[model samples]
Target: MTHAPMADPPTTPAQTAARVLLGSAMVLAGTSHLTVARDDFQAQVPVWLPLNKDFVVLASGVVEIGLGAALLALPRERRTVGWVLAAFYVAIFPGNISQYLSHQSAFGLDTDQKRLVRLFFQPVLVLWALWSTGAWPRRRG
Candidate 1:
């Protein structure tokens, strides 16, 4: 049986830059979830989720911190982390939708138009994660 190479393919300088930027951003955002923006993040939690909003916020904060650190520190696992982070973005989408639908204002998305526009950025984050970490690798023909 042929064993696959142990290492992930090398990323380009641009990809490395983007990954680092995203990793740093995640760490900062996670920090905010546990600190200054805790309440704001909680405000975005959907009431229907059943879990306590504060617990959800704090738990996600910890998760983000871990994922961000891993992304920064684990090049060999970058693709895995990228997929997971993209999934995380997808998983939390309802919070953004709830903020819009429930008319709960937080994180400067106080207006209907602003909230609507903000929804578009989540997909961009997903793409950024995938592309930066080579999860969505280019065709290798």
Candidate 2:
């Protein structure tokens, strides 16, 4: 009986660059939450929510910064980071829905059309998080 040879582990300069670039982008984006559009971000918090708008914005900025830091700091944690980031995206989805449903404008996204555009972009951001962490791999059968 003959056994098939094992496949080599995947490694490419492009993959390395992709990982680094993606991680850097997340880190930068998360940091931006601290300052850029700060008021608009605070305003996005649901009015019925118990927390103060400033607190919400600050808390979310911290979380994003932490998550982004993790993605950049640990190589082994990339996959886990991807999953966590995906969950993060899922968690914040309601904010987007709320904005759309309420006809609310924030961060210069005025008009239903622009808000709808944001709705469409959210999933892409999620996918980008996934892709950044090398969550997707080509399957061979």
Candidate 3:
């Protein structure tokens, strides 16, 4: 008979806390995307994108909310959530690049140095998603 995979516990307490914090952060950021920070988020939307900035921001907000909620609610699927969240971080990275290159100020990253520094954090977000979800350092046989 076929069997379901078991929910794997986080490798450490730090991982658990990371998962909770990152998930909460995502939800909060998404909320801001659809609310007070809409214009700030729009400033980061690449000019080359054919879609409307507001629409893009709103859609991404919904996506973030869903993914964040999933990460928090689906402990059994933590690994998958981690991978997906990491990919999402990667997918949104171009916005960061655009913000830096186009000199679009938002979220207090007004200075070139600040924007450049922000770029470096994308990888950390990816790592955070992976580590928190126990997706990286793949299991051994």
| Native-referenced Cα lDDT, model 1 | 0.93
Which of the two, 2 or 3, has more TM-score?
3
Worst 10 residues of 1 by lDDT: 3-12
- lDDT of each model, Cα atoms only? 0.93, 0.73, 0.92
Runs in model 1 lying further than 4 Å from the true structure: 1-5
lDDT of 1 by residue, 1-141 (tens): 999758778889999999999999999999999999999998789989999999999999999998899899999999999999999999999999999999888999899999999999999999999999999969978
As for candidate 2, its clashing pairs are none
Report per-prediction Cα RMSD to one decimal: 1.9, 5.6, 1.8
Q: Answer with 1 or 2, whichever has the higher lDDT.
A: 1
Per-residue lDDT tens digits for candidate 3, residues 8-114, read 76568788889988988999999999999999999889999999999999999999998889888988898999999999999999999999999998999989999
lDDT by residue for model 2 (30-113), tens: 666677767777656776678887877777877887787777786566767778888888888877877777888887788989
Q: Between 1 and 3, whose lDDT is larger?
A: 1
Once superposed on the true structure, which residue ranges of model 3 sit more than 4 Å away at CA? 138-141
Provide the clash count, candidate 3: 0
Give me candidate 1's TM-score against the actual structure.
Answer: 0.95
